[model samples]
Target: MTRRPVPEYAPDRLTAYEVPLRTGDALRTPHDIAAILRTVHTGTHIYLRDKVGTVMGTTLFTGDPATVTPAPFTNDDWSLTLLRCLASPSTEELPEARLCGFLFLAPDRLRLYLATEEAPSGMTAAGVRPGGALTALLAALPALLDEQRLTTTDADDPHCARVVDLTDW
Candidate 1:
């Protein structure tokens, strides 16, 4: 994957929210984001860009989410696609949801731009099919954000918190 300089997010724009650890589970913390990310197969990475177009850093998730493997993109490939979507005319009804970005961790470098009129709509990536582990995580994520109040201060675990708070969308 080609590495490029990621722009810094404005302090006012950076915000945090919570997502579910599991269905009906109430243990909400940014730390759990890594566990959710680990659901993806090895060599998979998720890029969550915000509405204002800010990318932070990359987290390498190296665990077995499922037996299947997803296709990998050559770094800039997915970024280019996301740029196209953002540049589209506002009048045009884009498939993108209000607070979402591209998801390109699927097999065969399968790229999908996940936008939701509301979040938790979720999308499939890599070999992680619609009902796969990744899909479940995405579906479960939005609800947690809606149900729980976010912590005002940064969590002690800065690394994992970075992954969870990566998106401003």
Candidate 2:
């Protein structure tokens, strides 16, 4: 892991979006999520959230898609396996699991939080600027999720205002 300064932003408020995932969507696997992260960042800390919205564990992801090892998808153990697999140098496959959401700490002072359709609150972001890495990733996600429309809520909106769980990821 490398040392880096934390980005500055208000923790109590954030801009939110709804990333709806229909059945058979490509964002279903850990590998898929890894690929998405690689597109916007060379390396990133990934925070995986469990059911009822809690941080289960986290791992550093810096692997090529082809080099990733494939693993069986099981709802019960996928999160633990994913943390172990990505942390290991030899094995690197994103196991299959229900991606309720992810908190991605990208390079260049960008912090983006994504909550899938399954989550109660939608996607939220802070410290995002136009044409920044975070902005670029947000733009690309709509298409990556098979062109699912993203509904946005302003940061000041009461409905959008919520506390985001922040980890090193």
Candidate 3:
């Protein structure tokens, strides 16, 4: 089958949300997001919403972090990555969901822009499949933000205190 062209990144088309980072939350870097992606496993449950607020629930599987890719554009102040995911509908009435979106990480918030169509083969060939991973991450963000302050090593060392290593226990 012929494929549709991948649209260029457009900030206007994206919907932005403040990630609600608490005063001492350690989830302040793109590395933290990568760590979260690395932690996702198969059969993770996710709840998704479309532009109009329709909820689509599903369970998804993911490949390794190598499958996740950096977006084409660059912003010195933000971290931008693309996560491609396929959602198998939880109910028969709904169709399968193909999520090809950009997750932009700023120091204080996250900006998400989900394409309305399927991802191009060139993009999906890497196969990161972050549907469940991202959903689980966002769903647990509040708790994660709240719990980060408890993981620091030195309260007096600013850099050391802000370091959060989610890759390990």
> Candidate 3 — worst ten consecutive residues by lDDT sum?
120-129
List RMSD in Å for every model shown.
21.4, 21.6, 22.5
Instruction: Please give the range of 10 consecutive residues that has the lowest summed lDDT in model 2.
Output: 51-60
lDDT of candidate 1 over 1-169, digit per residue (tens): 9997555664444533223344355553332444444334346455344312322432222323243242344334334433343445345565333333444444323223334444443432111122223334344443433332331223442212122221222
| Model 2: number of backbone collisions | 0
lDDT of 3 by residue, 1-169 (tens): 9998655444433433222232265433554444434344223434333312211322223322344332322332222232321233345653322333333234323322322223222221111222234555534432442354433343543322122222222
Deviation in angstroms for 152 in model 2?
18
TM-score of 1: 0.19
lDDT of prediction 3: 0.32
* Cα lDDT listed for each candidate: 0.35, 0.34, 0.32
Candidate 1 RMSD to the correct structure: 21.4
Tell me the RMSD of model 3 versus the true structure: 22.5
Judged by TM-score relative to the true structure, which candidate is superior, 2 or 3? 3
Per-residue lDDT for 44-161 in model 2, tens only? 4343342122122322223333443334333323333433332332425432212333333342232334334434444443322223232343334423333223333456634332
Q: Each prediction's TM-score against the native?
A: 0.19, 0.17, 0.20
> Residue 103 in candidate 3 has what lDDT?
30
lDDT of 3 at 134: 51
